[model samples]
Target: MIKSVLFDLDGTLLPLNQDDFAREYLTHIGAKVAQVIDPKKFVSQLLASTDVMVRNKDKTKTNQQVFLEDFLHKIGVAREILLPVIDEFYETDFVLVKSITRRAAAARQAIMAVIECGLDVVVATNPIFPASAVRQRLAWAGVDDINFKLITSYEQSHFCKPHVEYYLEIAAHLGRLPAECLMVGNDVKEDLAAARIGMTTYLVTDCLLNVKNAVINTDYQGTLQELAQTIAQIIKER
Candidate 1:
């Protein structure tokens, strides 16, 4: 019995080319903070810090904490100096990247179908970004109106995707066993990592991302429309 549904954002619910989105995102955010630090240097250090966050396994610090500590240290700036600027950028300039993302009608359908079944819905996007950025992306995906049981963000999550620990952390947050959760994502490796923890996996083929061309082994695979139909069938069986 699946008690919760976890959906990956970028390539899953939200259709986007990762590289293109990152380029547009960095361009906007870099411009926003150019006054405090050279945009070139800022982008470089920001990425390095993000890489540190991705590899971080420190349970003692949230991903945000790890990112900020390293980013601030490397840039030699106080949090008070850089944080507000970034926050303002997220509030104002972040929407500029939305043009690159198309709203997936099926994405909304799948999430609503899960909610209708009374299953907890979680936006299980990689926790490398701050909540503001994640929330904005969700808004662009057109699924931000409904409440999510948990929205994984750097402020809360300690691990990144493709790491089994990340799935475990989400399970812990939901107070549910991995066996009772269904992970839906487009990444062959990152999203399917949930299967390693005994969670059922659904691979969304639309906007699929298999960078390394790894063998894809998922319990269910199809478009978002098919996923919604699959859930409907499960509900009928129940």
Candidate 2:
């Protein structure tokens, strides 16, 4: 009885190499902020700070807080100085990164199929970026802001994926049990983790990442075209 479907953005929907996307994202932000600060020193420090934050063990702090605290510590400048610059990056530079991503028609078709089936659709992209940045990425995926019932961004999310709590939080927000939700994603760890709490899982293999060597034992695994058919089958079975 899956009542909702959650989709990951970067690889699952937007079809891209995660490393290439990250490099482009960092380069764009770094270049834009160079006018305000020393480019070499700022990017180097920012990358170092990001590494530290990624390894942070605190569950209480949002990813944004962790990253910003680390960033401010390295820059030693008023946070206000960087706020507008970051905002500008999201508004302008972030959109330019779309050039690196190829639109997946099957992804869009799958999303529409889920919506047509009366299932809620959630953009469950990792909550590492702000809402504006997430929105920009969604646009790259051909998903309008109105497509998803909920879009997970750092501001609204308290936990990152691979943590069952993050999935639980989304279930709570949607007022649905995990058992009634299906998480469709490319990452074995981050997306499939929702299954721990009872959500049905679908691994979109087109952009799959199996870094942890986790054995993918899920029953549902396929390409975007297969997913569209799977959803149709589910509807027919109902």
Winning candidate number (TM-score): 1
The regions of model 2 sitting more than 4 angstroms off are 48-61, 235-238
| Clashing residue pairs found in predicted model 2 | none
For each candidate, the alpha-carbon lDDT, in order, equals 0.90, 0.82
Cα error, candidate 2, residue 217 (Å) = 2.1
**Candidate 2 has what TM-score?**
0.90
104-135, model 1: which lDDT tens digit per residue? 88899999999988899999999988898898
lDDT of 2 by residue, 119-164 (tens): 8999998887899888887777787745688999877677778788
* RMSD after Cα superposition, model 1: 1.5
> Which residue runs does candidate 1 get wrong by more than 4 Å?
234-238
Indicate the worst ten consecutive residues by lDDT in candidate 1. Answer: 229-238
Compared with the true structure, model 1 gives a TM-score of 0.95
